[model samples]
Target: MTSDLKNRLAQEAQDIGFDACRICRPWDVPLVPDRLEAFVAKKRHGQMGWMAERMNWRGNPAALWPDARSVIMLGESYTPEHDPMEVLKHPGRGGISVYAQNKDYHDLVKKRLKRLARWLIADSGGEVKVFVDTAPVPEKPLGEAAGLGWQGKHTNLVSREMGNWFFLGSVFTTIELPVDTAEVDHCGSCRSCLDACPTDAFPAPYQLDARRCISYLTIEHKGPIDEELRALMGNRIYGCDDCLAACPWNKFAVEARELRYAARDELKAPKLAELATLDDTAFRAFFSGSPIKRIGRDRFVRNVLYAIGNSDRAELRIVAQGLVDDADETVRDAARWAAGRLTE
Candidate 1:
């Protein structure tokens, strides 16, 4: 029976290292199009113009594949062993997001999704497709719809069981399966996530302005950051976790079971001075197999210099000054800003 098969699929997902699994119909996420339209209308996605490019597919999963009847949403936790917020106090060290401190989750999660998808097809004889964070699927909304978690005020999915520290992956299939009940918001009157944003990226409750987010500035953004927001970035050189760290629900989070997600010893609290000294070759080698590699040398260095400017360590001025005459204009601009701040 379909019910027994769903149970097997859930068991397989757990055995494959996913912390949670839930199912829902493709049409469950009906609100995505309008929500996405409003987010894009305000030009809030910053330089990630790709958000505006895939409206049809992202807005409605049913439209992506007309015959697909169910969406299997899986959650994999990567909760850190240490307090992620602790690094912000040490301006001398760079704070990469816990998510980026290990191997790229996209590759790891996608491979797992494909494995589960293959099992579903072999068990049920249905065509299937898999997606991690890279695709145009409205994953957060679909996640909420699948009863895997609810979209918290910070706009990331939060589960009563898994908290806010999980990545979502989806498997779409033509086999119709029983769906799980959607989760409800449990963030009653808690402004912890909103107040935690260093850049005040949230314009209102349950909304975000990606333009001002440190994560966007350091990662997706290709050029120099606005000087106003750069100062707020502090030592966070990659993705910012202020909101996720502030979520009180994370107390119940399960630690990641996958060894691939464990933080590398060298990345725990990298020295900003050491990071600023990386040339293109060194940057690539240092970040190989890590998600930070995608940002490349120039952008990564630009972020490092921004942290250097925010760092009150006067000795770090020389590190910034050395890069002031570098080939990349953006890196030079960031270095000049950092040198000026340190000397001031």
Candidate 2:
């Protein structure tokens, strides 16, 4: 596709409600190998072995598809109407990650990216493949290379205009499209994200120790959480947002245009006592089509137990005690931990 055709595609994408779009040439992602090595060397990736699996392929976007010429990177905002931080104040309530508040973004983003790729094919007479987080591509770096955003110190892509609440999707095409010059960092002299972490997850500027990260603990960490970090987790039952919320660039973020990202009534601040009782069936039914479903009842209950343990409310003891003999060992461990916290 010519430069004019790619630019038109970007404009058309915006008209279709895509917040940001950029075209990046497939090339060696130089920084990713060191970053992955740093993460693995420190055991920061934790139990997510996939991060350590592929080497050459993880550092080169072209490795995923040698014939591909450009990566069309897209961003969709998922900002909430109300302050997502506000839910953390209510210790009795569970804080679901803002991204997973309503609907699954994977299906939503992939559908739109595919539509754009189809348009690109019709205009350019070429083939394309769509990817939404499922592929091994280094999306944040590609976004930076494509002028969509800079990868912030938090290691997530940040656009001066979109903040960190956006989801990334890409379409790799054989067409040699014009590239958008990369974006530069504007995080100048700001350390709000590093300072705000409850568990001090950021070990250094631009690097995160995922082991200490609450999001990793809640979602990625398979076993019971480290006891020291449990109380610091506050009401966050799924993922933490201290780092993302602290970025000043977030002022440009408008509320999510799609209703799927708008907070649901029951999800905003669900009762810990009520959630603690969810069986495997109830868990599936309640979190159907939601990202939380991927974790299953065992891990979700484990997190609830952590929250219950942090709660000073003696009434939740009954709920925690009931799970002391849960079928999942992780849940049972968390229950014992909760029971100990109340008794203490």
Candidate number achieving the greatest TM-score relative to the actual structure: 1
Using lDDT as the measure, which candidate wins? 1
lDDT of 2 by residue, 204-313 (tens): 88888888898889988998788889988887899987888888989998667888888888999999999999999999999998989998899999999999999887
Report lDDT (Cα) of residue 215, candidate 2: 89
Model 1 collision count: 0
After aligning candidate 1 to the native by TM-score, how far in Å is the CA of 11 from where it should be? 0.7
In angstroms, the error of model 2 at 199 is 0.9
In terms of lDDT, the poorest run of 10 residues in model 2 is: 28-37
User: What is the TM-score of candidate 2?
Assistant: 0.97
Scored against the true structure, residue 269 in model 1 reaches a CA lDDT of 92
Which regions of candidate 2 fall more than 4 Å away from where they truly are?
Answer: none
Q: Candidate 1 lDDT (Cα, whole model)?
A: 0.92
lDDT of each: 0.92, 0.87
Clashing pairs in 2: none
